[model samples]
Target: MRYVTTAGVIALALGLSACGAGGNDSAAANGSPFGDCIITGEAGSSPLNLISDGVVTVKADLPSPGWYNGDTVESIKSGFDYCLLANIAHRGGAKGLNLQNSSFDGLVAGKAGSFDMALNQITITPERESVMDFSDPYYESTAGVLVKKGSTLTQSDLADSHLGVKQGTVGQMLVDKTIKPAKAPAVFPGDAEQQAAVAAGRIDAGIQDLSIVLGASVQSGGKLTVVGQIPTHESYGVMMPKGSANVVAVNKMLKEMKDDGTLDKLNSTYLTEAYGVDPTTIPVWSF
Candidate 1:
């Protein structure tokens, strides 16, 4: 799972605050003050970034390198190049370039034309698909519950427990609708905080992406453990402006990555260390 930054939230809130500021003048001149294309995504996760007017901007909350086997900064640099290689090695490949180093200030400064694409652990939904074009899913994950090691909670005990979850995530939604705990679920901005809440016993358990929970648990040295699995499905995709020409180019390269086993190899190298399970072993979603 990806992380969200306080700055992004502030920016979004500010945008909403200014929605009626200029009105007709803003609308008739540049078309919209918000017309400047910007990509918004979970921060700190290696697999996503915000692109503004074609410039890549890093988010403030970068994921820790220990989360995956190939999560080193150097490995990320190399793995990102796979997108470029796919373009050169395959027909209709899209070109991608590294920009900022996953920082909020860097992204705001880099904003400029059409943000070619933004990739993160963005869940695909009919409402979103209606407004943006998305590449084939790059990763699949499920919602899961985590508790501290030696905690009394069991897989069958969480139906009545208070849960911690990142707001707006599938995990939170699942817990809200399925578990329906009496107390309102504690909401945090990112996985790190939710994990921390579980470790501190502030919350009886946490609901998050399985991969994120596994990675956090491994990094925490057995401080956390999976209590139960939430029956929710989610996947990640690369988002581009609807009907943009770059869509075809990006999809072509992604298809090549899929065909040449590069995607699988990357996942095997990174996800295995994080989740202690091969993503390939998971059943594919049939849509």
Candidate 2:
């Protein structure tokens, strides 16, 4: 089963400490907060939609990229996306759900107007918890290093190699806190940019989430390989308004989804079995 880690337990304690500050503004004076749950993600892209009649319907012109297959809504609605959707539908308390395009800054800070919940692979950290509430982790991931095939780069070389990491990501944090490369890390705009830089030989290695780097290795067609994985505690949670009563309800649904094997099926179909990467077989590198 998916149990919260030690770090997550501390986070929950800290979150409880702030209870004196009061619950989310959306909360009802009587108790629970239930209404039209507004789901949001970065603008210029459709990150969520309602599935109807076996077809995923999008509110925008483009569709959310849920998996490696395509940007089509149907193609993208597996894994975490499906887990979140299935839980919400199974819970059945909210008046309705609506999708809105928003800014990352706004969503991370829980100030994205009109949005009750936010998703999009956002990581939960203590700093962010001071301002927002996070649901139980839907995805657990670790840092992974991607390198050119047959490049013979060892774990020891990682500390001195020219590493590439995306700005404002956990990969960059891992590099700073654990890898400590001799030279400065080559910062890129995002995962795509960092992967491209590694592919072009602009950097010695690319550091990112295991799923991302593993997918890169598969798509590279024998050009790239995941050299190692960092043993770190990291998970993605649904961000919600701070002190929102919905947090409890959402967590319950997430746990139910996990217990019933729904989450395992989705992960197997979209990530583990489909990607052909044995997470256990991936070599572990410590900090």
Candidate 3:
């Protein structure tokens, strides 16, 4: 979920310690973006050769709001990632969509060839392409600031406040490069730790993806709220196993969705209507 600046930050943050992380424009030329593969079948007419019969399996760290929207697959009624993959499953001619819970770490490094793809807010990088295949870019995101409910701290307090960051993320990089808090940030391994820290008052704030912080605010039961955002140039794509056969089909579906307004509709349905927060209305804090 972290962006590439220091490749190692991506590795440690996402629990993929075995490789470095950074962007590569040559990914498709190197066959990581399905360059060697061609569209072989019509959408929804021919079922894919999936990991399961009559099903398209997508792995993600569930319970993430603005994305998974549920603590588990059975509880998921709607979400950006869940609905997005549901569309992909339908396009692939699968009768059902299988959303599985997995560790954000293991989902990247292990389970090669065991699932169809992953849509866990992952950014494509040359180092990641070494281990996984990526569909075309689908969504762009910004950094949202999460804080304690009813807290008086504003963006003005950011300079001296104890800010927390998920270890090895673009948010951390932005905090370091842009915000430059007087106190060094408290860094944690994943969303849970950072969220917990903010809720318990150990830190003044936590910064991560807009959807991530917003989702936390929704699930926080009035204990947390998002007060501001930092615009960041980060885009996410669907991740697949290294050299996956389905990458071509996934890309085809993505192109159609983007061209036909499906992507925009989903953004409204899940991020706005479902989550009750329009990212546009959140203040863009100037640090």
* RMSD per model, one decimal: 12.8, 11.7, 10.5
In candidate 3, how many Å is residue 214 off? 1.8
Clashing pairs in 3: none
Q: What is the C-alpha lDDT of each candidate?
A: 0.47, 0.56, 0.66
Runs with alpha carbons beyond 4 Å of true place in candidate 1 = 1-61, 64-96, 99-114, 277-287
Per-residue lDDT of candidate 3, residues 1-287 (tens digit): 21122111111011111122211111134432211122223458534668777677777665556565533445554556666776777678865666666656566664533788888777565646778889888876677788999888887888899999876466777899889988999988778788898999999999987767776777678898889887776667899888788888888788877776677666655555434455567888865
Q: On a 0 to 1 TM-score scale, where does candidate 1 land against the true structure? A: 0.62
Measured with C-alpha atoms, the lDDT of residue 157 in candidate 3 is 87
> Residue 159 in candidate 3 has what lDDT?
82
Q: lDDT at 55 for candidate 1?
A: 29
* lDDT per residue (tens digit) for residues 220-263 in model 2: 78888888888668787877777665677667666766787666
Error of 2 at 98 (Å): 4.5
Which order, best to worst by lDDT?
3, 2, 1
Q: TM-score per candidate, in order?
A: 0.62, 0.70, 0.72
Q: Best-fitting candidate, measured by TM-score?
A: 3
lDDT of 1 by residue, 1-287 (tens): 22221111100000000111110111113332212112122122122223433223222223233221122222233222223322322233212333222321122223322445544345555546776677766655565567899988765557667889775567776777777777889988666677888999999998866655655666678898765554455565665566765555555556655676655554444333335543334332221
* Pairs of residues at least 3 apart in sequence or in different chains that clash in candidate 1: 3-43, 44-61, 44-62, 44-63, 53-113
Model 3 CA lDDT for position 77: 44
Rank the models by TM-score, top first.
Answer: 3, 2, 1
lDDT-best of 1 and 3: 3
